[model samples]
Target: MQFGPFLKKSLPKYLFIIPAFLFVVIFMLYPIFYNIFISFQDVTIMNLKGDKSFIGVENYRQIFQDERFLLSLKNTVIYTVSCIVFQLSIGFLLALFFNQQFPMRNFFRSILLLAWMTPLVITGTLFKWLYDVDYGVLNYLLIQIGLISEPINWLGQQSTALMAIIVTNIWIGIPFNMILLLSALQALPSDVYEAAKIDGASRIQSFFKITLPLMKPATLVVLVLGIIYTFKVFDIILIMTGGGPVNATQVLPFFGYELAFVNFKFSLSGAVATIILVILTVISLIYLYLIRKEESM
Candidate 1:
């Protein structure tokens, strides 16, 4: 085929991608680059529309020095790590259980997805009432079960506020993790398990030697995705605690939001947003690398 003819043949195929390419550039890339630019400028409500001075890295410096930022960072780490660990562990166990032949297995799995399907705002609002110090079913049940003699201020006390949010997030996350893992488990080769059983391998041994090794890729994908989703949590905190109880449940996204809207520190908020972008970018790169490695294997 001549080069001219080949080019003409492929031209139409390439033309079809232009709209999607332009959409990404306009909506996603443009906003990201604009935010990065704003992060380097001294933008505030006073100078938002006027001449904004380019004070490179000053906003980042100020953000680092701010005590609330540091506290929110700490809380974010705690919340994300806690959610991932509990969500993965519980979800894995649930997947394993549901993978077996059992009565009403599909029904139970479908019901569990209600928490994940519900909007985060609604879930947070529902949990807010559930975590209420008084007239909350959770505290009432705890008291009835003799776990505590008093109604614990789950969302009002700083010590328990973050934990309460973590629990709520975990509940929301579990079904997602379970569904992904269950799909992976069901796709696994049954012949391998049969062979392992023929070799007199115990269920635990088969799981450790066969199941875990095969599930590594899916598990890692789920873990990284869980981190990405959990790290950017905002609405839940807004509805449940508003980062209150002395900023106990404050997280990075909410902190950035507060800086921009409440404090009107647009530059600082932009810096915070850039930081989150960088962190998630690194994570995404890791995920891509893992996927490539798995494919190579």
Candidate 2:
């Protein structure tokens, strides 16, 4: 009798999850397994050869020896950590500002969404134009204002190229992060502030004690997602510099593309992809564990 009732009640929820379940099974899970299989065998976009020999760990071994792969790993980690730090800091500040009562709040918030809602490809292209050394608005304006002795190559030299991409990504990311964090901030109870004020707690004290603690969930989510998204970055890199002027901006995703399509090393590419997946998986598990621990406290 209990089983029947529970099944009947959960039936609607099962229907709701069906589309998501199917999507993961067909897209995510299958592709991952297929990629693992692909990594074991030396296959390419054209080769119809069926000579299959099990080369255990050879692909991974090649990955460690490849300098580009190591550099890509280093670059991906730097880009991810940097993006998370700046994006979270800027986003939290903006979220706090928007959460407070202000004149024309809605108008300003709508304006902020322009960066978030704009297509990333369009943004990448726009930045590419902005960073162009000659006849570009940035160089033109800087030169006119005499900001520097000469026009800086924003996306050329190894030193400035990664920074340029980071600036563009942070600009695109901050608005979306601000919007989400703002929603969370608004949901915080006003009564908590009142009680803190009664205790003679300053705004700074209350923010540290109440706001920061409550925003833990949001911070954790953003940090995890930012790491993942930054690791897989490609569009802006492709549009802005294409990892040129040396390998300054060659993060993992672009590295994988260069190996697979540019160099036609399909087995090596698959191994690199699998390694990336493992790293992301480990990070995700750690984040989830931290989130659970936070909630428990």
Candidate 3:
């Protein structure tokens, strides 16, 4: 390979990447670095444009001590875990169902995508009405089915608020998980399953031994993506609960929003945002490692 010819030929391709590179730097990398820098400083509304003094880890320390921050962290964990578990499991089941030749399978799968395709704001608002304590469809259905004597305050109480949000997130996330898992299922080699069948493996046994193992990469991708998306969920919560019923549905993203915009604690919010970034980065790294290991296998 002649270096000069190779460089000339690749120059336009490299040029094409420059715009994308600059966009990432301007939009993503710069914001992240700036947030990290601000997290170490006292960047309140008072000192935002004035003099910002270095506070080191004091913001982080204070946030950890704050009861609301702790609650938000706990809620975030619950929300993320619940969404992932239910989304992945339900999506996998849906994928399995849709993978088999069935009447109206394609139509049903497309219908599921409507939930995923709708904007979060719209979905949140719709669910807000659905979960209304009085005159809500959910309550009416439950009452008709004799599940409860009265309409439950789904987003009103501390006990049920997080779960309500979790359920919404799960509903929004299932289609994405299903589509990805379905694609993986479709791509799997049929020979393996056929061999397993010849060896006297039942459907359940084949799924556990062959399908599950083959689906690991896709499953890992879905899980990591789901965790990242669920952990940073802000809009739905904002629309449905506003992190409320006394901070019941507060997650880290919403908590950070409250700190920055509501309470004007910029540094504290930055700290919270940085914490979220750190968590997502760690999850992404683990996912990469798992993917590489699976690829090697």
lDDT of 3 by residue, 1-297 (tens): 999999999999999999999999999999999999999999988877898999899999999999999999998998898889999999999999899998998998999999999999899999999999987799999999999999999989988988888888889999999999999999999999899899999999999999999899889988998898889999998899999999988889999999999899999999999999999999999999989988887
Clashes of 1: 0
User: Each model's TM-score, in the order given?
Assistant: 0.95, 0.92, 0.95
Residue 222: error of model 2 in Å? 1.4
TM-score of 1: 0.95
247: Cα error in model 3, Å: 0.9
lDDT of 2 at 110: 97
* lDDT (Cα, tens digit) per residue for candidate 1, span 161-241: 999999999999999999999999999999999999999999999999999999999999999999999999999999888
TM-score of 3: 0.95
State the C-alpha lDDT per candidate.
0.95, 0.88, 0.93
Among residues 3 or more apart in sequence or in different chains, the pairs in candidate 2 whose N, CA or C atoms overlap within 3 Å are none
